[model samples]
Target: MVIFGCVGIIAGCGSLGLWLANRIRRRPVELREFLMALSLLDTEIVWGATPLPEAFGILKERTDAPWQGFFADLQDRLQRGESASIAWNDVSLAQNSHFCLKHEDWQVIRDVSKGLGRSDRQEQHKQLELIQRQLALIKDQAGIWSEKQAKMWSYLGFLCGIAGVLILI
Candidate 1:
């Protein structure tokens, strides 16, 4: 009877842990999809020689719903006397790399800004493509990480449940 009780407790905990992991794992993928879509638009704007501030602002305005929070945060950081690099660092911390900007992304931003002045649209486009590709790669890696973490959590939860049962026994 004690053994049975232990197994029941373990099973319950394992189920709960798996549920939580599944919930946590789903959002980042959606975020990545949204970011990938945004990257396409951003690439166009950058390559067209649009000013970085204007491009960012426009993108922020166009973004919708849950996704907007990140861009809004980025805009706020950028507006409050933060350099692009610093702003990106904050962004990297706040968001998963799939959706959040990074140092390299900022470098592209800086290059686009400079390229615009130099009328080097080609370079700006090239940089935009590079950034988009980087983001795509990050998104792919993030997907793998999320899946792996979810699996790990499930396995650990199972182990924990087994331990709990053994304790009761």
Candidate 2:
């Protein structure tokens, strides 16, 4: 019974560590997705001259989960006569916990909607380009951090499990 308990404890700790590591790993990937989505939005707005709602619809169709959900919600809100800024803020606030982004990342994302539909095409393009550059920097940092920390978290969890078992024994 004690052995079984120890094994269970170890497994649980290991799983938790893996979960943390996975979350860390997902940060960069999600950021990259965001960048891609932003690029597409830039194309739609600048070159194609597509309006915000239809642009979001295209984004919704092009992206995957989380982003797809975000764009879908934003598109819905825009169609319902909500301004782009308000809808963006609303969606960001409502779905904040669903993402693995950091506070700075969220801040940048929130800043995106400020000049969105209100600005001219050149201004909007510049804004998106700036945001993309910032996100790219963040993605690079996150990728480096994840590479260093994920393994540490995974190992630490197993080590903690062993320590706990030792204490119990």
Candidate 3:
């Protein structure tokens, strides 16, 4: 029973590490998909010549989960006559416990929201393009962190677990 308990502890620790690493990996993918959705919105604005509220209403293809909820909330807020910035702020996906976004990610979204639909078409395009560039850079950084740190976190957890078991024994 003692040996089995120790083995369970080790396995649990290792699995916990892997789970955390998965969370780390997930952030970038989510952010990238979010960016793609934003780009689609940008296309609607620039090419389709749609207004902000209508553009949001027209977007049916959400690439991920919370984003659909986020946008739905946003549209609802807009329908209530709240400004774009307020609506975006109100529909914060970052506040979700299951979401893997960092403060930086939240900052990016917040910054993007602040000017959304407030500027002229040309200026909006420029602003969104800049946001896209920033998001791409952050996504790259997250990819690197996932690649390098995830293994480290898993290995370190396993080693730490083993060390703890040995010490206990």
Taking the tens digit of each residue's C-alpha lDDT, what string does model 2 give over 76-127? 9999999999999999999888888888889999999988999899999999
Which candidate has the top score in TM-score?
2
In order, the Cα lDDT scores of the candidates are 0.61, 0.94, 0.81
Worst 10 residues of 2 by lDDT: 95-104
Q: How would you encode candidate 3's per-residue C-alpha lDDT over 31-136 as one tens digit per residue?
A: 8987998898889888989877777775544556767666766777888899998778767853455578898888887777867879877788888889999999
Q: What would the TM-score be for candidate 3 when compared with the true structure?
A: 0.90
Better of 2 and 3 by lDDT: 2
Off by over 4 Å in 1: 1-12, 27-31, 34-38, 47-50, 61-67, 94-122, 141-145
Ranking by TM-score: 2, 3, 1
lDDT of 1 by residue, 1-169 (tens): 7767887888888998898678557645554645564574456555555655555566667776444565676668777867655665566456644433335434433343333323455665666566566556666766777788888888888888988777666
My TM-score estimates for the predictions, one after another, are 0.57, 0.98, 0.90
Better of 1 and 3 by TM-score: 3
Candidates ranked by lDDT, best first? 2, 3, 1
